[model samples]
Target chain A: MSLAPWRSRLTLALERNPQLNARYLQLATVGADNRPANRTVVFRGFYVDTDKLKFVVDARSQKITQIEQHPWAETCWYFPESREQFRISGCLTLVIANYPDLALQQARQDTWQELSDAARLQYTWPDPGQPKADAAAFESLPPNPKEPLPHFCLLLLQPVQVDHLELRGEPQNRWIYCRNDVNDWSTQAINP
Target chain B: MSLAPWRSRLTLALERNPQLNARYLQLATVGADNRPANRTVVFRGFYVDTDKLKFVVDARSQKITQIEQHPWAETCWYFPESREQFRISGCLTLVIANYPDLALQQARQDTWQELSDAARLQYTWPDPGQPKADAAAFESLPPNPKEPLPHFCLLLLQPVQVDHLELRGEPQNRWIYCRNDVNDWSTQAINP
Candidate 1:
């Protein structure tokens, strides 16, 4: 896929913000009760050769259920050094076991192989969002790097709209990019 | 309104992160189309002696319409210095002209007065989220501090639940604080 217009801008922002936290972003989803739920999630990089952004989430996490129910979500990412913000709204695709896409399954396995042993160990510890357990309960052996556990799922967001804001300008600058049904992206500069 | 269980932690976080961006947060709301909409907004301090967090919004902005349709929203704040994150979920209250509460009207005016002249002039600019206009259209004069424009609104969030996560700990830390109908808050540590 050719690089999206907004994607290039985001790449520049990421390049300018060299801090590690630049990969951290806030993801929002509609909960089962219809209340808005949000949390910080790390960007696992773009899905291999695709425009879809990749993130890792435990299938046992609360957000898994939220995504199953509503499917729609948004991510807000801010680059402090660049003083820019990107709000991308899209549908979340959770790649769980038996996800049906063989390529994505291979991608998930590759993503698991890329994680550090410490991160992979946490997935074997306990169910997330559950009541805190004793410290001894977290001493599980590290999982194999080649094979991710059943619950270690890849969360992909295929963006449909992007609202980017640059806060360092005199009056500031804002742009909205919308992808139509035919997958054509149209952008407009708007009042900030 | 007494201090919520999660409020004290957030207070400490703010004190630790002395940077200007500490007050900026990502707010997420369900849009008119049922898709999640997220944006970065400055935290304009709390309402007069109440737990309701106050924020200013351009009534002409798209979020105003989104919030009008779906009042629920969540604010995700990350403190880099403390390595902590707070996801506060709640219902939104918009105080516009002809609002019933006299006290809130006073609070809204007080909030308007706190903005810088440059910020105040933005309320006089053309509609937000609209197509690009000529550069001269944004040269509107600043409004009176004592009397805010009709579209200058106070957006308040009365939190119902807070998910606080600290990424500094060995296994990390997470707590969920929920407020019941009677306004009492209960907190529980969760697996992170």
Candidate 2:
């Protein structure tokens, strides 16, 4: 059979993952000491039509620098007690800053509203090296139809390979699917 | 304030997360190439009494090897809609075969039985590199009235630091709680 069947399964699997929305993804990158450094990021959205995942990153975040130097990245998503998981590896690209997509930025702000009082404090103060924005920063921009942040850019990831892992028994089984150059996927049961 | 207050809060959080019984944890390790490699492992149980997180791993797994070489590791858990997350980093140790009570082993086995058919398939055909049951390997051996799988070991991680990330609207906040050598915890808010 043509690999179409497996491609369909892969697409469906991505859709089945409820955690894919605003999921917490940990990106591992090489640090100054050559040790692995990982931090959590919010998943903005996935383009099932294009088989691509989208996120936002500060142009100056340490991770952005690491990804630029080494494009290979691994992302992990976990939901407690849920039998769904995604361990994906792919190359990431910076969507041009001028991409007129305020919709994504609005959705991100909406999701941010759902956090607790304690959680809200985390973002009010940017981490060292993270792009800084102040109250005046938002005031200076014209409110005609968009919010302006010079450092804002959409980050798109085209997954090269994804391993869909389900909670089997003690020895977890993994279906490793790889996307061909043409964006089609092939699945194989690898040694879990 | 007494530390008991915070510990009690943690207890409530754990209760709210009962479904956490089955969680996917990403273990980041230094690969031979000096880059980071991550793998997902199911959390077996938590020793609340000892304040340790427990999980099973194949003695031959790459992560096990990595831990042997470098004990520093990070574990992360998140809920997408809740926008709440738990991140843990600390030293990890592998429990020897002669550990845990017989009752506990039986309880774990019972939980294993509750998994669905697809889940059962993962362990039935054991992966050589993962932890699994080998009935034939144990057939000739006398059933140890004490412990099952005398070769299997549970890995325990004593969290040195734990961070909570909350992504509510307007402001995002992160709180870090660190354990002193004396077992006392100090918590403070950090920039997100």
Candidate 3:
């Protein structure tokens, strides 16, 4: 229940960079055929007070299948304003209908409720990565705000290793934090 | 060689975002134990007008080992000024001393000569990702700028798939360009 050592630095980054796009980060996963797949994913904030980072993905997205095959992922976030980067290596847990965790299932629902109407409607659109639909088909009707569609998934990234690099420094300050099996994190400053 | 379809958009992004950090991108790769690893890397530009994207890395970096194990990588670049994202997924080719490509070896030498003095000095410093060295040890002596050090490498990413997403649109615009084995590219407009 203790705070992650990098938490304060991440907090500082968020406070210093107020741009909405600052919340967007890159999520990289191993896809089918073991190809490295990456895309821009919105950072949905930490899961409660835990180190787990929250993100939402449509069940129909290729990332869902990629996660199913290989859950290991790395999230690279850069705050342009602060010129800092954070790369968190972790496994992603997709909260789907049959997923076992009831608490997480509830969290999924809560996350859905918190989404903007435009964002929620995206889940109602035709599946991503598919051939383009008609322009009219792109305009989707707003779905119910209180509940998530079956395909909407709350993805949680459980960080096992965190790398923070500050680009503003003389030689660029870099630190790596690794979590033990018991969840204790040890931090080390390394050459940038 | 013909240009990739996404090239123009990427060019426009660079033109609009004149910040030095605009060239910084995230490179994700499968590392030791099949875990995902990622970090920020500088984009060094195209290789002789080919589709390959260039980057530089030290031989002492962990990425070199990871590339030896799994060449697959994804480069995710976001242009905050233009609100555009480019994700290039491809396998990396390390142009080392023993690499067979003569042109690339020369390209490596050319790229080495183009680096700033400070950037070139980084390779002379203590190995990255290693335990923190003494402050005095951190100040490394400059190497010959005309020639790259033994461990300096030119990493080329031969992009097989290029995903360009424009976040400025209301629904966002995404296009994925895929290359066939013959190097012919086919593009698709997919739902964002």
DockQ of each: 0.78, 0.20, 0.74
Return whichever of 1 and 2 wins on TM-score: 1
Ranking by TM-score: 1, 3, 2
- Model 2 over residues B1-192: C-alpha lDDT tens digits? 244223454555556555543255576655555556566666655544566677766554566667777666667655444455666777777664433676446544444444445443333344443333444432232333333344345677777777776665344556778889888888776545
DockQ-based ranking, best first?
1, 3, 2
lDDT of 1 by residue, A1-192 (tens): 677789999999999998989999999998887777888889989997777999999888888999999999999999999999999989999999767999989889999999989878889877877999888888888888899999999999999989999988767799999999988899889878
For model 1, the superposed segments whose C-alpha errors exceed 4 Å read: none
Query: For model 3, which pairs clash?
Result: none
Categorize the docking of model 3: medium
Query: What do the candidate models score in CA lDDT, each in turn?
Result: 0.89, 0.56, 0.88
Measured by TM-score, how close is model 2 to the native structure?
0.65
lDDT of candidate 2 over A54-124, digit per residue (tens): 76666545666777676666677553434546667777766544545665455444433444444333322
Model 1 per-residue lDDT tens digits across residues B94-129: 999778999988888888989989889888878887
Cα misplacement distance, residue B67 of candidate 3 (Å): 0.7
